[model samples]
Target: MPLFEDLPRDIQLAAMENAARTTLANRYGITPGAFTLQQYEDNCVYRIETDTGPHTVRMSVRDGRPPHHQASELAWLDSLARAHTVTAPRPLTTTDGTFITETIVEGLGPSTVAIFEWVPGHAEPPFREPGIAEGMGTVTAQLHHHAQTTALPDNFARPTWDAADILDRGYALTHPDHPLLGANGAAVLRAVAERIHARGPIPERDRGLIHGDLHRENMLLTPNGSIAVIDFDDCGLGAYTLDIATVLSSIHRLCRNDSEAYADFAHRFLTAYEKIRPLPESMDRFEDFLLLRDAFIVNFVTSSTNTEVATWGPRRVAGLIAQMQAHLAGDTYPGTLTS
Candidate 1:
């Protein structure tokens, strides 16, 4: 089935900022916040500048996730912040006094729009400073611990990250016969997924709400040397290792050309995280989770028509496929964790 975000670039951009700001102005009877496009990956992010203070307005094409699910995710973030689990973005109400509002576009169907008080600090690169990796580890442990003990809301519901074909089937750019994946390539993808699952079902303690996409850009490093996590839009029920795998896959893809750089980052991040909460023995299954995470990225890029991505798609896709092969073969990685 064609995904909801299948709208062409111009149409998608047209549904954002300018229209959203005008709608807000008409509803609230006040000046709307000035909006500048921030990012355009899974969602259309805008930096909202107002005289009062800066905020953010995020619009996601309802690719099966509706306003309610987005609201549930926001509610969870609010709770996490209140309980000191981690510094998180707080939901901003629209003029209708709701955290999430639905906007029906001509052909794209209904999209979810929400606002958040922007976090002040920047998300530093993982290798930017000495303790950056350690900080990521420390904060991620705190989030996992929170997911373990907190009482979630009644309406809390989101799909598990591991459900087969969830991303591949839903992505508009991918299908069983896509040229990039080739013909037998479809079979290869499923076989790897099955092999990963055969390792056995995850134990109860190892599963819970996860920030499904915590790669570097999704986080911010505040001036006080603390972490401010963002983009919980992808949070859902899954193995805690799913979260680790997401970050690990990021390190591998980013430093694919430099093994030494990968080692330095993997060590500091793993060492600091283990210091807070010892690496779960369940982590022996980490490579499996890594493959799953990398597959998610590969699916997104190949399926996307983003101009910049399309420009480099051929090279990037090949590199990702190679990384996946080496990862599954246990070849491209260094020590599992650095001391």
Candidate 2:
């Protein structure tokens, strides 16, 4: 079992793409062109057309994760869909009667893959249209509300996004100490960690099943003109603020310190979020979660074998650190507003 990193960059990507296509053709018994490859990096996402119509297939990602973690995601996704609080890509069981199964990608070895109904429609541009935030907020609140009320199966298992998770990812962001992080960046990381520590344990009410990576790209504006979420692979139990911050995190990057634009988004989302579920008056924890998400990405990109992410990671981390500094100085550009 050769690790993805053991191979050179070009070799790693070529091998993955080839393996993905082969896995679909062989294990899934799909012909060539049945699945159009949408992404070829950490995971190979394809728009698959089958006898049952259209679905998305994710394959050729990290093979290291245990299969049960994937099963837990499917369990919750099915529950969310049934509850009608939010629509997620429903998992389709494989020929073998299991939703989450493994496929051997020849030279790449065994990799976990699953099929999901393609939630149609393009990604809503972050805050491009007025009231989009309200719609997103309403949907998020519904998701949280449902999560709070639902009971899980006794055997259900999911990871926690906590001190341990942060520590696990911290090394990747710190190692070789990229020139981008520099001295100020290092200090900011330390201060943010301390602030998070001072908050004590996250309150139970503020923690539940969250769409752990709920950025614009992972969203779909369905034909019914509703916001549908996709890619729950990162879904887990965590701070409710973490989920809220994930949405704003992408908007923050897009706004690039434009306080007015960021404030508009914050106002709309908070106003609507509170309509369905209570949102805290003080959004001070927003910036902390933003930093946490950024740190996670830095670590994610660092570990990825994808050439593009490897090149972009350092610069993105540096930019986020600078924004965090402005936030500490009371700039509070994006997620710190009230309507």
Q: Which TM-score value belongs to model 1?
A: 0.85
Taking the tens digit of each residue's C-alpha lDDT, what string does model 1 give over 48-142? 77766777877764364676788889888878868976888887666777677766555555667777778888864556478888888888888
Q: Write the per-residue lDDT of candidate 2 for residues 51-166, one digit (tens) a residue.
A: 66787887746643468888888888888878877878888776566767776664677788777777877775447686678888888888888888989788777777764476
> lDDT scores for all predictions?
0.71, 0.72
Error of 2 at 194 (Å): 1.3
Worst 10 residues of 1 by lDDT: 165-174
lDDT of 1 at 174: 46
lDDT of 2: 0.72
